[model samples]
Every structure is written in structure tokens, then in C-alpha cells.
Target: MEDNVKELIEITALVIEVIGILVLVFGTFLAMGRYAFKLQGEDIRSFQKIREEIGRSILLGLEILIAADIIATVVYDAQMEQILKLGLIILIRTFLSFTLEIEIEGKLPWKQEKHRTTGKK
Candidate 1:
């Protein structure tokens, strides 16, 4: 890779990773703040909503981090070991995202009939 392009890719990856981290932190605090405010005079049942929001943020953040990893790995390393490590990292993140999705929605994506607008089963 050209030196300039390599530097740009590295910086882009770093920025993406930072954005991912920020999303997780900001989302968690936002959800917590809302939940706390609701506790004062609102329904406590909103806990589930808050939990889902947090999980969604985590999922989004994980995906963003994965994108950053891909970009960095492609630009900075091509060794078999690095590729394997990237694959493992992606696998772990994907599993985490999958579980979070299930936890938040209480169902698999394909099984979400209610979440669909056409109401088709």
C-alpha cells in the first residue's frame, strides 16, 4: 500500500473504533439517565425498553468496531495469523451481537412477526 493511503486507512480505522466506543458509552448513559428519570414519576415497566435500547447500542457498536478491525487488518497486515485473529474476533463479536439481539427482542430476527409491518406470518 502507498504510504499516504496506509496512513489514511489507519486513521480512518482509529476514528471508527473511537466512534464505536463512544456509541456504547453514550448509549449506556442515555438509557440509564432515561430510566432514572422515569423512576421519579413514570412507569417502572419501561425497564424493558431501556434494556433493549442499551443492547441495541451495544450491537451497533460491536458492528462498527468490526468494520474498523476489517479496515485495519486489510491495510496493516496480511499474515495468516493476523487473518485468523481477525476472523476469531469477528466470530466472537457476532456471537455477542446475536445473543444481545435475542435478549432484546425475545425472538430471532426471522421469527419476529410482530416486529414486521405487513403482519405476515
Candidate 2:
């Protein structure tokens, strides 16, 4: 019964992970449409800011999915290999989240306003 319960939990986690992946994919489409359709403003700087925010949201969703995946793997197989893989996934996801957070929050180390005005300088 204990093993059965663990299996069930792993299955649930896998389902949640798959759902997260779908959400991430949909968010990507929304972000892409925002830029491709020019749904925002005539000002490129404003559009760029909107684009960055959308990208960050998508990244956040991906991070959630990665966490779900790691949990599912560990639940299914509590082996050293699975643990290592989970650690690597979490590390990469953390870095992505941190980098995107900095950009979306406009807390970049360098003066980003000038770069936005000058276009990727």
C-alpha cells in the first residue's frame, strides 16, 4: 500500500508537470503574438519592455514546470542519478529565473535605459 501511494503521487506530479509544460507553451505563443502582431505601441522601446515582461512570465512558468519534473523524477526513482538530474534542472531554472527577474524588474547592473534608447548597445 505504501508503494502504491508513492506511485500515485509520482503520477500526479507527472501530470502536473505536463500541464505546466502546456501552460509554458501557451504563454510563449501569447508573448510571440504580442511582438509579431505589434499589439502594443508605435514606440519600439515600449514594445521591447512589454516583450521582456512576457518573456519573463514564460520563464517563470518554465521554472515551475522544471520543479514539477524534478519532484516527479525523485518520487518515481530516488536514486543518485535522479537526484543529480533534479539538481541540475533546478540550478539552470534558478539562473533563468534570476536573470529574467533582474531584467523584468529593471534592476539591471548597467544603465539599461540608455541601452533601450540606443537599441541593444
Candidate 3:
């Protein structure tokens, strides 16, 4: 029973990672195609829109990947060293996510909704 649970967790983590990769790739392709179609008319804003769309997709993919890493490490691994490594990985990914969010939105994640609602940057 214990082994079965471990195997299930490992599989689940793998599936999550795969899904993240698929989302990232699909989002990129969709954004590029959409922008390309729009660019036929020489729209200057298309580039910015594409970049924002791609950034959002990447942020989501990174979050999903982080969750997969946590599940694989925390649920299946029993070693303290592995857990510490997982912590570092999660920290780095989180920082990257924050940076990406700021880059894409021109504001911090927490401030984004407020800025949108207030129409203030």
C-alpha cells in the first residue's frame, strides 16, 4: 500500500510537469499565430500584446512545474537533503514568477488588480 501511494504520487508529478510544458508550448504558439495574423495589417500594439500573453503563459507553466516539483520531492522523498534542495528550487521559481509578473504587468502581482480597478498605475 505504501509503495502504491508513492508510485501514484510520482506519476501525478510527472503528469503535472508534462501538462505545464504543453501549456507553455501551446500558449506560445497561439500567441505567435495570433500576433502574426494581426501583424498583416501593421498593428504596432500586437507585439506588446503577444509579449504579455506569452509572459502570462510562462508564469502559469512555472507555477505548475513548481507544484510538480514539490509533490515529487515532498511526497516521495524522505531525505532531509532532498527536501532542502526542493526548498531552494521552489524559492528560485517563486522569485522568477514574481519577476515575470512585474515584467509583464509593469506592476507587482498584488498591486495589479488594485491598479486595474482604480485605473491607476
Q: Candidate 2 residues 2-121, lDDT tens each?
A: 888878878888787778777777777777777777775675675675667576666768777776876676465668886887778878887777788776766864644556575775
lDDT of candidate 3? 0.85
lDDT of candidates 1 onward, in order:
0.87, 0.73, 0.85
Model 1 residue 114 distance off true place after TM-score fit, in angstroms: 6.7
> Can you tell me which runs of candidate 3 are displaced by over 4 Å?
39-44, 113-121
List, residue by residue over 40-121, the lDDT tens digit for candidate 1: 2344478777888799899999999999988898585678898888899989999999999899888897886753777667
lDDT of 2 at 83: 81
Q: Count the backbone clashes (under 3 Å) in each candidate.
A: 0, 0, 0
**Worst ten in a row by lDDT for model 2:** 109-118
TM-scores of all candidate predictions against the true structure: 0.85, 0.68, 0.82
Q: Against the true structure, whose lDDT is highest?
A: 1
Native-to-model Cα distance after best TM-score fit, residue 93 in candidate 3, in Å: 1.2
Question: Sort by lDDT, best first: what order?
Answer: 1, 3, 2
Considering every candidate listed, which one attains the maximal TM-score? 1
Instruction: Enumerate residue pairs that collide in model 1.
Output: none
Compose the digit string of candidate 3's lDDT tens values, residues 1-121: 9888888999999999999899899989988998878852455477788988899899999999998998898474578887788889889989988999999879766764536576775
